[model samples]
Target: MVMQTINKIISANEKINDVLMNQSGLLDVVVYENASYDLNLLQAGQSLKVKVSLLGQNACCTLRTVYLSGTDADNKIEFEVIHAVEQTNSKQEIKGVAAGFGKADFYGVIRMPHGSQKCEGSQSHKALLLSDNACIKCTPELEIYADDVKCAHGSSIGTLDETYLFYLMSRGIDETTARQMLIKAFLLSDMPQAFETEIDKWMEANE
Candidate 1:
């Protein structure tokens, strides 16, 4: 069990990306000021835990996860974020697609401790099932111990939308192409542009 720790002071209006791939360990990160942080997780297995802290005014943090599982594969990810100061914001989004007998689980928690006023936090988890025996579970929790703060969380699991698929097919797009496009859109919607090439390679290999 390896532990990675990162501590940094972000200047105003700065943005950074922290990317992890195929790792089974613990990660800790902290950021300050009007900066933005993007935490991306791809193809993780075994178990992973991420702890993030946002400090200073008008800071923002985003956590995005994309996972693909096949038969007998078990993947799990856990994330915790703390808005330790006022006027901070945080978000978590998770997308997964499972096939065969694969199983995936995601647990995310956002905390606004006492005295951390005027903060905003949100989390969303969505998964697609590609086979009858595939399973995915998501749990999002929010703890707001301060006043004048806003928080929300949601989870959803389903297959692709047939109506959207049909609409794409009606426009001269092949079914396979439409499905691939939709899957890519779902998994990469919240990702940064710098990750486009890597995500494209992953999609091509999986396809």
Candidate 2:
């Protein structure tokens, strides 16, 4: 018999991503075996270090994070994913934005030591800078030592599309509102539908 992974939807527009929305406080780093996980790190609170381990035949997880730093703020994020068992898989997707005079550092790693066979892992990190002094550092690393496994990591940083801003403004949107709309879309576009409203509310309040 072939083993199967069950994914139960929490709501009409929610899936595994909503399972851990409430627990994604950027500090609740814990190992949850044999389950699909989604971690949404909204912003930097002090400095954060995240780590995850995948072991056993049924281990699977997906982690997602986001960060937006205000002016004159400094933030650092470090995370690692280790695959140590066979038939396990994991993925990490990260996004961030830094305002003027702010600095954000994103460092991530994926490791598959010897004997960890038939394991698959993937990671991606992307960030956007909002001003001249906005700074973001993305570093993705991988260490593979086992056979019959697949692992990859990537990082990218960019700025807002001025053409897109112009297009939005041409449609009669004020500059400030247009800017806010673009920022919101960049930060929350891929988030689960179940969380878009609540997170948008929180974002506005925090802004």
Candidate 3:
């Protein structure tokens, strides 16, 4: 049994070394960008890949909402992932929130190399839209060359749950306050503890 934690800080437009997290090994990756990057992970047995990408534009404040809320239609962020191996099990779940005119595009590809057996993998990408012009696209692809693997992929783009909003309203929160709370929750869902505090502060100043 192997147990370890992998943490790395990468500059923009850099290529990260291939990370292999074996059984019982934990991998955590956080990426913030104005540039591009390539990250690869391999799983011979059971593996976990935890990744977070913060794509922002310093030249424009309008893009901030798109980076966090996933609602700005003019903001464009693209993400891609590829998996290649056999008997390799993996789970990848990505969540994003967009506000204002921000936009996001997610692309995921899972491939089972030839001769791989009993491989199982699942991928899911979800985003929340906070404005009328907010835009998002999710595309998950699977290419299996082996016959004995079980794999699945899913993508969803939508706004906050109205039922949750209604419940908040019933509990005495005003509509705008409820919206703000929900939006915060959505944007912070996958952020790390260290960054969450700073992100909240930034949100306060920007919003």
Candidate 4:
């Protein structure tokens, strides 16, 4: 496959395999020197699976995914990124919120094969629960076969921070607005500006 520069946004409503996979079930992304492929995905009340492969030296990918669950909704998402050559790099950031009896689960993996030396990969999954009945879980895995690689993975499931809320409330903001602001701050880094309206609606409806 010839190297092509690509930066695209993936829609949550479409099936992952239909949109991203080839006949062999892999999105064989061939990136090369000075090239990159970037994808941003948002999922609400749906399940999605994605596998991306970086095929050459100096290839790079950056993926940002968000999972939002509504009332009584169950959602799961899995992501895998494979670095097949030396000097490749990738970073994945995942964020989520579950409210009103909603449940969310995420699994992510970054793999670097034996000869893929000097490759760098990092991923983090973080989720928050808004209701007492809400549930959230995250599992992150890093498989590195090369000794000269830098790879890290982290996962966390938690609720909103009260101290940040308190700080906002002290400035005369109401409890509800303060809480929402704090939650928005947590997600601002990874979310795209294009989804602002949709995310605001989700927050309003979940509240």
Candidate 5:
């Protein structure tokens, strides 16, 4: 198993692959602070599984860490698998958060070739908006050239529910903390179950 988390301001392209089988390949990814990545490529095979999580914190104007306010921040992730060559397929889960006046974009593409049969591929992207001025763009794409493959993709961007906040506040939870906790939970929805420890550490830091 392999685990990796990106927690800095990234400005270049990157390529990553997770191959899970008897070897059990795994990955837990987190994009924190002012972290930024452009033209990122991710590949996973039928025998590989990976969980990706992204959190945007302190989109404020601080001297040490400049706010993430770039107009040309491009992030693209492509996950493909050839299932016929292998079986008992893999899984890919992606999640993200965008707050304040910051901008976020995610593009996901999952492909299953013609000969690949009985392969399962699922991809999802979700974002939270803290301010009305915040901007987020999501594109969930799937290319299936095989008839016997199961694949799906979904994307959503929304704000915290007022009713949920009210319920938490009634239980003695502060409003601000309630909102943060909800956002944190939403961003962590897609993370794999096996990486709970890493997820705990990330929540501690991001929250």
Candidate 6:
């Protein structure tokens, strides 16, 4: 397994994108005040473990993943984060779209280890199913071992919202355009602007 350690001081309102693929490794990140992380995963297999330590107050972290697989592909992601100090914040939003007969799984854990007071953490995982034979699993776990901390997690698996699709189509948008818009919103809404063009090309090629 490979291990990487990153330590940085992010100025206010700065955003960074960390993208990884096809490896088994451990990542350690320290986030500072008002800074954010856009963590993206593509075509990942084997094992990927990430641990973020929020060191400064009001530091924010966001995680988003997209997995496109074929019939024999097996992809998995494991993520963990800790609010190391007081008043830090983190959010994990993982969006996965699965097609063919492949399997995709995401496991996330957030912890506020002792003395990390007033920290807030939240995680949500949503999967889009495009084939009857495809399988997608999302497991979000939280361990709060501190006082005055708030944390929550959620998981859901479903196709696109047909009601919203119909609503957009009724407003003169074609079906294809409406679908693409919905997908882009779901997967790219919180991504950093620097990565938008690359993600757009990826989405078009995969589509």
The candidate that achieves the highest lDDT relative to the unseen native structure: 1
Query: What is the TM-score ranking, best to worst?
Result: 4, 1, 2, 6, 3, 5
Residue-wise lDDT of candidate 4 within 1-207, one digit each (tens)? 332333333332222211121111123344555457676666777666667677767777777777778786567777788888898889888888998999888888999998989999999888888889998878888888899999998888888888888888989999988877777767766567655666777788886
Q: Could you give candidate 5's per-residue lDDT for residues 1-207 as a string of tens digits?
A: 253332333222332322221212333343333332221222211122323332232111100000111123222233332232212233445554444445655455555556545556665565565567767676666767777767776767778889999998999999878876676566444443333344344334433
Q: Give the TM-score of candidate 6.
A: 0.73
Give the distance in Å from residue 25's predicted Cα in candidate 3 to where it truly belongs. 26
For candidate 6, write residues 1-207 as lDDT tens digits: 554454545566678877765445566677877778767766533456677878777777877666554466556777888887788888887766766676787889998988889989999887777568878888788888897988989888898799999999999999877876887677666654444564465446544
Writing each residue's lDDT as its tens digit, candidate 1 over 7-46 gives 5555577898878676676777777888888888786345
Residue 202 deviation, candidate 2, in Å?
8.6
Q: Distance (Å) between predicted and true CA of 46, model 6?
A: 6.1
Worst 10-residue lDDT window for candidate 1 reads 1-10
**TM-score result, candidate 5:** 0.54
If scored against the real structure, what TM-score would every candidate get? 0.81, 0.78, 0.58, 0.82, 0.54, 0.73
State in Å the error of residue 74, model 3: 6.5
- Count backbone overlaps in model 6: 0
77-184, model 2: which lDDT tens digit per residue?
777777767777888888777776778888888888998888899988888887788788888888888978988888888988889999999999987678778877
Tell me the spans in candidate 5 whose CA falls farther than 4 Å from its real position: 1-88, 189-207
Which pairs of residues collide in candidate 4?
none
In candidate 2, how many clashes are counted? 0
